[model samples]
Target: MELLEANGSCSNGSLLTLSCLSHRVVCQVIGNADPVWDNGTSGNSWVTLLETSYGFYIGLGLAIFSSFLIGSSVILKKKGLLRLVEKGGTRAGDGGHGYLKDWLWWAGLLTMGGGEAANFAAYAFAPATIVTPLGALSVLISAILSSYLLGERLNMLGKLGCMLSLVGSTVMVIHAPEDEEVTTLDEMSSKLKEPGFLAYAAILLALCFLLIFYFAPRYGQSNILVYLTICSVIGAFSVSSVKGLGIAIKGFFAGQPVLQHPLTWILVVTLVASITTQINYLNKSLDIFNTSLVFPIYYVLFTTIVITTSIILFKEWVSMTVVDIIGTVCGFLTIILGVFLLHAFKDMDVSLGNLPQVLQSGQQAPVTRDDKNILIEVDNSSIAPEDKPKALA
Candidate 1:
């Protein structure tokens, strides 16, 4: 061991390789220097050199657990709404405050709040990319739960979609970014004020202003995307602010005097404004558009924008390998495809039970009346039926 306990600084101003008893641990390196390393142990083997801290795993676990809670909360909320309908009270869909009085709704809200709190804590420990894509898990959870809990039909495609989301999520989590650009509130403040982020924030705000004042007043009702777009755009800003505020919170809990810093207040104000805007516009979109349409679109846009913003703000992509990057993209695409299948075919009656018939028809090369009936049923399944939902409530 080097006897320089007073100063652990490296002479190169970046790297500090420590010689322990068994091996040398590279403690620090600048930028993307540490993400990948050729250890010269074997040919054609590239190892991802993560510091492998426990904090990252903690964040990942919290993010995953939050997804389950959030997913369950959706079922609870929907149940509350259904119960209100049974009681002959005003429904929330019609701007009624009756759901506020329902215990089930409050339970759902509290569950969601707990999930959000877990997610908030997750941001402090994990990279935004790692935490963000994991939201897909919540969608999968909701689909599965709704199928079982709410008596919603999940066709074979939906089941396949859930599986795809799982596989993709696993790939994404495995290849997710591990490094944090900012560790302390002071460092986070500097990152927030960086010119790149400031420009992004300015341009985003301008776009929101035009969309809200001009486009929304004129065409928002006609085109639901306008409102959803606003929600997605604002979501990017909200996520970044969440990261900053997370750092402030983490520092504060560690007995650091983060409250005195202007950046702490700045992050708080930005978080509140952005989160409020996102929720308001999102609620508007939900009220106007069918939830089946809103969910996939909002999730896709919100996640994509947050990812882009994270790249610019935290520079997480700076440490990514080409293979890891490709894996992440493929994983995200898989998740999107899964989400599309799950929501897009929610009302369809397609199932594994019909697979054999389809295969037999394909192999026999005979267009029988049974086959024609199957084709007709397939065509008719596309139209949504107006029927009371089978609630497990």
Candidate 2:
């Protein structure tokens, strides 16, 4: 309005003439454009600035707090968690089974601690956009561990589906948008700077295991201990991977003073606690469900967690093309469905202990259709001595 009045410029070359330009309106618009920090206002406004300055800290803080709360709740609720180890040992007919299971759980927890340290460090140094995508490694690690340690069999279709999902995830990661800011070699001179990709992959694997153990039983109806053990290892690897990624990005190794680093301490402590809780909870859940049914649900839940974290927290997908997003989501969905199918076909009637019975019988068990045939045969053979067919009568 002031400019217009000074220049005496009005309906000369404009799309529409302002009926009456007012100085007050211009002042109001200008006032609204002022930055919050510059406005000199006090109160809750500082919260936003604080969050922005320490956004990475906030993310790791939330992750640790949430893990603690959840882990503690699980341990407190299921007091019979150790029973799972005993049970597994009894099933295996090895007196040392309990000791072995317990040691495995401990090792898993240690690995998880390492992974968490890496994860928090990574989060502190880089955006979650870069960190969370590394979680895709979990599936690969879990699959390998399940096959080798647990003797879980994967059919051709399941193997194919895993490969496809991996390809899709790789494409998504490769095409992901990168931040314009660059970090030079000298900045990352700390001990935490080593083992980037390997550490991140380990963290993803551990987290995946944790998720699978927690959710597989309610839906999959498979063995919970097997799933839990697998999940624990995966979770351990994921946390480790996260820490390694941080080191790699920053290119520094803060050796000798690892525990002194706040982020490192937070990651390690939270990760260990979380993995222990996960193993305990998973062991309990396996007693309640079959593994195949349980694992698929876990996968869906994990995908949701990662994708949600990626979008809302890091805005990883803002620059992604629609095709890439669709392909990634579809691939995840396909893997989930494939896991469900695997669980559904797993024989629920026969426990792991009863495998010999199923094999030695050498005949298929009677289904609903078989019952109908048996009834018909009995009726035909009996012939009630006087109630024969009408034609015979």
Candidate 3:
């Protein structure tokens, strides 16, 4: 019986040893699973989520909403400026800043800011290739609204242009590049340092200087292209800066403290400076030119430059198939064509001869059915009432 008890005691000891080993293994696993690992997993999951179809849709929806707001803001701001001008404020070229006091101008400015904010958010989830071209929708909206609300006439060709822009926008959205994974400011910095992008930036700066110092003084008022070129060139840098700022903000919210980086601050400053420049020049263009003429031209040029800059900076086409690239190019061209149509046909209804006809005497008046066969009595006062014609029966 003592031997049996010793064997039973040994078995109990072995069981205890095994249980302790199992407990240590479980503890080691729990200890090794650190927060860093969990955080990395979460980060990856978040990126995956942003790269999904739903994220694209979200970006697209925001872009559409932004376009509408921006379009409406244009009309409101223009109207406000007209009111200010009527109130003895100088024109935009004559150093008139009197629109600052106009409540409608303030409202329009706020609306535009909201639209820009929405656009900035969209850059966080979608590629610029998609967001920029979709801006054509704003032009479309502005054209249609101007026709009804602002009394701008949209001819048949202008209508065709709107349709073309819509089709092009649809195609671009379908063929847009997938969002690149940009988790940190360092990644964005690396992109900015790419040789191609740097060259593009240099060229843009040089052109902007030439236009501002030389061309602007000479042709700025008469040539819409001069002002538009400045805006478009500056716009490229602004868009990139906006994207960088957005990424930094996203990283900061993810517990990364990306805003502490110097690059983030640089981008922030750049975004502010660029946007200010854009607003100043865009307002000048609006004040000088018709909204219908300015918007399409501005959109076309701005979109072209922005897309080119995005492609160079982001290498968005690296992963795209050749067919996709071709489709994107075709879509962009179609949008340009549409813009051209809108611009070319905007004044079709207004005839230069109509003014002369109105000023000329003895112009033929419209004949009514009742007056078709009526004979009129003629008075010859110069003939001393002897040459007067009697009324016909």
Candidate 4:
């Protein structure tokens, strides 16, 4: 059973909370609950979930919570981000902020939120492994949105990445594991009591924070603080929503007493915090990077964070063949690399095929040694100044 750590870094606040929600926590909860299915329940596959009252409730609850968190994060992050944008612009010598700004910001947030919500919903219903790869769809979504709304063009590499993501996600979806019988509340809770589970959760949480510490200020093309905050908030909420669904399910079977469970409280709070963080990151990223590149990478990292945690928490691969395990990991890594390559294009200033034409048009483009690096750094330098996000296109 997966056992996530719970009690280290209690001083770290949300960092601690995130650690507690790891897949190990899920396993610990299940094991502790000592759950028994409604009889004739199959293995832990999705199909089995449909055969019982508890499974349905649990799955449904997760789905709803995931949707809620995703939706909330999108709106909150977009609004918060826009405010930052306006503040930045006014400070940076851009003036005359008005209704158009609000309109544009809200509109973008809503659209982005909807897309994220769909992806989160998918995650709740399926395993993170399956849901994660499917998130590649956001690439295509962002591309279309950029072309139609932002007037950005996708060159050959961009188009290739989008198509590959689509094809790969489709394949992964078809091959995802089926659901099984619903596990009881006691089973989930009991597992949390284990030492290993708590240890693992703590370790994962530490790693997450470490990444936040290192990455938020160092490397991203966008605002680091904003990026880290956004990631933290989104992850916190997404994880919480997932836990809340689990609690609600557990409560349904073993009396409403579980409604007041500690895990439940953790879930709710995490969901809110996570959403807040996501908005912060999105707003900052929107300023420096194209939506096509930023959103996909954000989602990719989000998925990676969850699924990687899940692997240890549940010991999810105990039943898998060696080949299957290797293949699954390789597939996930490929998607990550593909996403990186896809986003790399955004770093470049000129579109590949149109480079000659643009030169002929006599545009004094921001040319330098590796124009992409200049774009990323100049944009990044403004991140900490707290301003309205500049459009990168």
Candidate 5:
């Protein structure tokens, strides 16, 4: 009887072990069969929804605010330079680096830096297509400020440019592509390695090197195109670097160890170098050229390059419907037309005959024929002695 009971216990233990193994296998099969169990789709969908809604609006708001700050900063800097010139400082085009010590200059620099910081933060949350075109607002703001504060003229065409810029911006905002989800440094690195992006980067770098080393010294001061070329080409890369660093920063704060990634540091370095170069050349251009001319031309070139770079790197257009793409193109063309108008018609009020008068008189010619015709012709001999003394005094 004892032997039979021991056998029974052994058999029960074996049965229990088999039952546990079978249950584990069944659970594994069910889990494997379910597509959502480990696919990560649900999490991605949630993030996408959040980004498309509040994240986009926040970015757009920040960009608009940045435009105001940056536009104001440009005017302030110009004022500071003018003040320095009044104080016996050299002209900006004459290699006058003395603006460095001016308090107002420093203030303007600080303000610009603040605006750039806001723009940088904006990139982390928004698509570049939206953020970049909205930058045209800066041109409008600068034009307005130049008219009011700097006493620069904004002709009828410039006003039209401002309106077209607004219209284009509105259209772009409405049809802007959704922000691409970049959750990790590895993902960004992968995108960077794509053949299209790699080619674009190589071409940009090569062109920048040629412009800086060869063309800059020869034509930089005389030709507006030289400075613009350098800034716009390198600016495209800088924007990409900004986006990369922004993503790394976002990830780092989200409990990821993204700081340890090499790509993050690379992007940081690229952004600093690119921005410094851009500012240096931009200041040069501003110092030499008219604000109205510089702002619109820079906007057209920089926006074009940046948008092209973003489209290539982020593939923002891949998911867009054909209609959206067409609308974006139309909006962009409108902006280009506006810029052309600004450039072409900026001096419409100045007549061809007035050119010699302005040059000879060393002053702007009167805008109206009545003012020009009202010039007084004084006869000194005909004036009485007492009146002569009063007039002389």
Candidate 6:
């Protein structure tokens, strides 16, 4: 008001005449343009953030339920693998197929299949955004169960690593650089037919072929990445295929007969291929690496590749603000650091509780400036009774 009064000469060439632009009305738009909250602060206010549709609730429930099942399945499968080893059968890490005959392993597979089905059903009621992030729950549940069930010791450091991974993943999901597109079958078909995506498909196939045939045969047992890379790289293609297949299925149900289209068959083929490869490698990774370690690393790497592939193929990732970009980079760093911690000292028995003992041991080491003092103490401790007195003298 003071500034307006100081500039008093106004209405000459504006849209409003003096009579129309009332002092009180104009002042509302001038300073306090937005409605203030009850606390007298200007910001986005909401009555309730939880006012979502019932379908969303259903989807959320399904996702959480699936997580528990999947998490438990991981342990069950691991136990089955251990049993297979004890029975003098070849272990999975060593490229053995003995797990197929194990009833316990079959049970785990069935349970995991059910969990995956539930997860897929979730996407029916809710968007991919909500369903995707809840995936970390499986990792958490698996980590918790592994400590007790499998006795894969997730000490204080491992716990911290898990926390970091979860936190980072949450940040990454929240601020993932993406814009929206590809809602319909036509748009998806177009995306699939694009030269860029075709190129991506070709390169991906080549890389995966090499990794699976050449690299996996050599390093599959020794390293986690060999198997996991094949899994992770195929993950993007799997996602794309799943989406395309879902669209085609929806069209089929609507009487559009999309299933008759060659594109639909292509999608079906791609989905089956990608899923087969993913499952095989994923199993090998779980068998070889610590379950807790594998979960977070796999989640992180899969998310990274999915995002990258999204950017390249679907052109979905774009237009992040400066703040969002920074958040994303920080989150990426946190995940990398978490994975590093999980890998680096996985064999070491170090935990946060070990810190005090280390510090105390460092503090307790006796120091002597004089060589004579050290020699006397040493002589007294080492020499016999008569020699001790003689050495002291």
Lowest summed lDDT window (length 10), candidate 5: 384-393
Q: Please, what are the lDDT tens digits per residue for candidate 6 over residues 49-149?
A: 22122545665677678777777776777677768768987645445778778888778767777777777665444444435545655655666787898
Q: Return the clash pairs for model 1, or none.
A: none
lDDT of 1 by residue, 41-140 (tens): 2222221112134678888998998888777777787777768778988655445668778898789768777877888878888888878878878778
List TM-scores for all candidates, in order: 0.77, 0.39, 0.69, 0.56, 0.69, 0.60
What is the number of backbone collisions in each predicted candidate, taken in the order shown? Answer: 0, 45, 0, 47, 0, 0
Runs in model 4 deviating more than 4 A are: 1-120, 148-150, 180-185, 207-258, 274-301, 347-393
- What does the lDDT come to for candidate 1? 0.71
lDDT-wise, the better of 2 and 5 is: 5
Q: What would the per-residue lDDT of candidate 3 be over residues 341-369, giving only the tens digit for each residue?
A: 87656655433445356347445423222
Question: On lDDT, who's better, 1 or 3?
Answer: 1
Best by TM-score: 1
Q: Which residue runs does candidate 6 get wrong by more than 4 Å?
A: 1-65, 76-110, 122-136, 148-153, 176-180, 212-227, 250-256, 280-300, 319-322, 339-347, 359-393
Maximum-lDDT candidate: 1
Give the Å error, residue 111, model 3: 3.0
TM-score for predicted model 6 compared with the true structure: 0.60
lDDT, residue 160, model 6:
77
Flag regions of model 3 displaced more than 4 Å.
1-53, 75-109, 148-152, 218-223, 283-293, 350-393
Worst 10 residues of 4 by lDDT: 384-393
lDDT of 3 at 10: 38
Candidate 1 ranges beyond 4 A from true positions = 1-18, 21-52, 83-102, 355-393
What are the per-model C-alpha RMSD values against the true structure? 10.9, 21.3, 17.3, 15.0, 15.3, 18.7
